[model samples]
Target: MIRTFAFDVGETLVRDDRYWASWADWLHVPRHTVSALVGAVVARGQDNAEALRLIQPGIDPSAAYQAREEAGRGEHLDETDVYEDVRPALSALREAGARVIIAGNQTVKAGALLRALDLPADLIATSGEWGVAKPSPAFFERLVAQADVPADEILYVGDHPQNDILPAQAAGLRTAHVRRGPWGCLWADDPTVIEAADHRIDSLTDLIPLAGQ
Candidate 1:
């Protein structure tokens, strides 16, 4: 039986389209400004900091400064809409004897979006404040150890193949693909991943049955 549930933050619970809109609004720039920043990072091949310094120029170049500006804006986009259904899914799981936590690549205070969405405090676990990035074995080790649930007893639900499914499965956690959101097209392209997934859901609501309480 699954005793603990962990989730990825960005594009899993946090909506990515809305995240882009907020980034555009905050810097008093066009929507493509956000796109350009991403393109600059991917195309010019620099991390987020170097991209921001090139695109924005005036802002301080610290990691925190760059991340907060982006994260803060994303949270404010669409007035920070919560995943309304996600809450009930989590509540049901918790009621069914699972401890829910989120592990994602994000800045400190990463739970602010979840908090704005009104998720319960304890559900966030040790991730956000601790500043762990994904695909790192050490990050996964620390989170699993903190939850105190054997890897087999935890299910990590996320949307990405690389950042979410592969690493978690390698760590011995059961995996669920959220199946569509930011990563929808990638999922469509690679249906073979279904082979790796223990279960699949279109939305958080479907998780109720999959986790088997």
Candidate 2:
């Protein structure tokens, strides 16, 4: 009886190849070098922040992110940035009477970017707006309030095992592990993490049938 579906943005609905490339450009390093560094960090179960700092010591993360924002402004998400299955999948869920929303940890400009791209989501929300990030009980509580439903009736779909799957499940929402993004694939083989998700999807299209559409 899932009545609502909340999706994660980055690497779940969209892939930001240029975002990391821009970081490389700012660091004056080869894009592959930076990309590989990020992969290495994730391989060791470290997060992106650790990877960035390891690659460029003394790199001010906020400043680096501001640069990414500047570089990303005019270059909004194009066809390639979005996953091929997102549009059709979201449409199917919406057609099935699901209230589909997108929520994630993103920069303040996320709203603008989402508006510019005009994705299929009925609503888009960010951690910036809520002043809290995922894995915070308050964040999920806010989502429950926003959705106006019991937590058990909501479905949260995201790529991150710890941030999305575990936290959302703990918050009483059925969780879906979308196996596409950095964190998704990184923990794909972990039985503990994988089994925690009520549903597992390699493609967003898989959600269509799962949502009873």
Candidate 3:
């Protein structure tokens, strides 16, 4: 039985429109341009941040991020940034006696912003806080330890195939691929993603019944 439901933040519980928009503003580039570049990189199985590097060659994303933070324009999340299904889904799962956790590859500031929203989750964490990012076995190792349960009893849900589904599966966690974001939609039908994910969902609400099973 899946006793714990762990969610990925970006494009899973939250929409990333504001994130890319912020970057566009930071770089003084058109939002659509950044969007298109992001799509192109994602289609090529490249990192989403590659779009930024494409915008400004030799740019240091970490340095840019810190500069944005200094300018008071770093990562920000509000209720509007969250998916409509997130609250109800998380609350319902918690109400059903399932452990609800929100963990993903996000900055520490993103973690703080997520907590400020007060979503119905038992725990919220990020890669920055953990000092480990996804697609890494060590990251899932931390998650497994935090869940304090057998990895198979924990369901790791995300919109990224490589970072979420494959790695989580390799770490012994049951995986769910949510087809909402660009990567999710593009790769949803791929044999690899389909074969890796134990469940394919379009919305967080879809997991409500899955938790009961």
* Alpha-carbon TM-score of each model against the true structure: 0.76, 0.91, 0.97
Q: Residues 15-118, candidate 2, lDDT per residue (tens digit)? A: 96777887778778899988888878767767777768987789888887776667853335566788889989999999888888898987667766776777
Worst 10 residues of 3 by lDDT: 204-213
Q: Model 3: clashing residue pairs?
A: none
User: Using TM-score as the measure, what is the rank order of every candidate, best first?
Assistant: 3, 2, 1
- Cα lDDT tens digits, model 3, 1-213, are 999999999999889999999999999999999999999998888988899999999999999999999999988888898889999999999999999989999999889999999999999999999999999999999999999999999999998888899999999999999999888898999999989899999988989998756
Predicted candidate 1 versus true structure: per-residue lDDT over 1-213, tens digit per residue:
888888887666766656555556655678777766764564343554555566578767455446656674323423355565667888887777678887777655445655555574245643546656677776788778878978888888888777678888888889888866636445734665687778777788787765544
Off by over 4 Å in 2: 67-75
- Residue pairs with backbone atoms closer than 3 Å in model 1 (clashes): none
Sort the candidates on lDDT, descending order: 3, 2, 1
Q: Model 3 compared with the native: what TM-score? A: 0.97
Model 3 residue 147 CA deviation in Å: 0.5
Global lDDT of model 1: 0.68
lDDT of 1 at 54: 60
Error of 1 at 198 (Å): 1.4
In terms of lDDT, model 3 sits at 0.93
List the candidate 3 regions with Cα displacement exceeding 4 Å. Answer: none
What value does the lDDT take at residue 185 in candidate 3?
Answer: 94
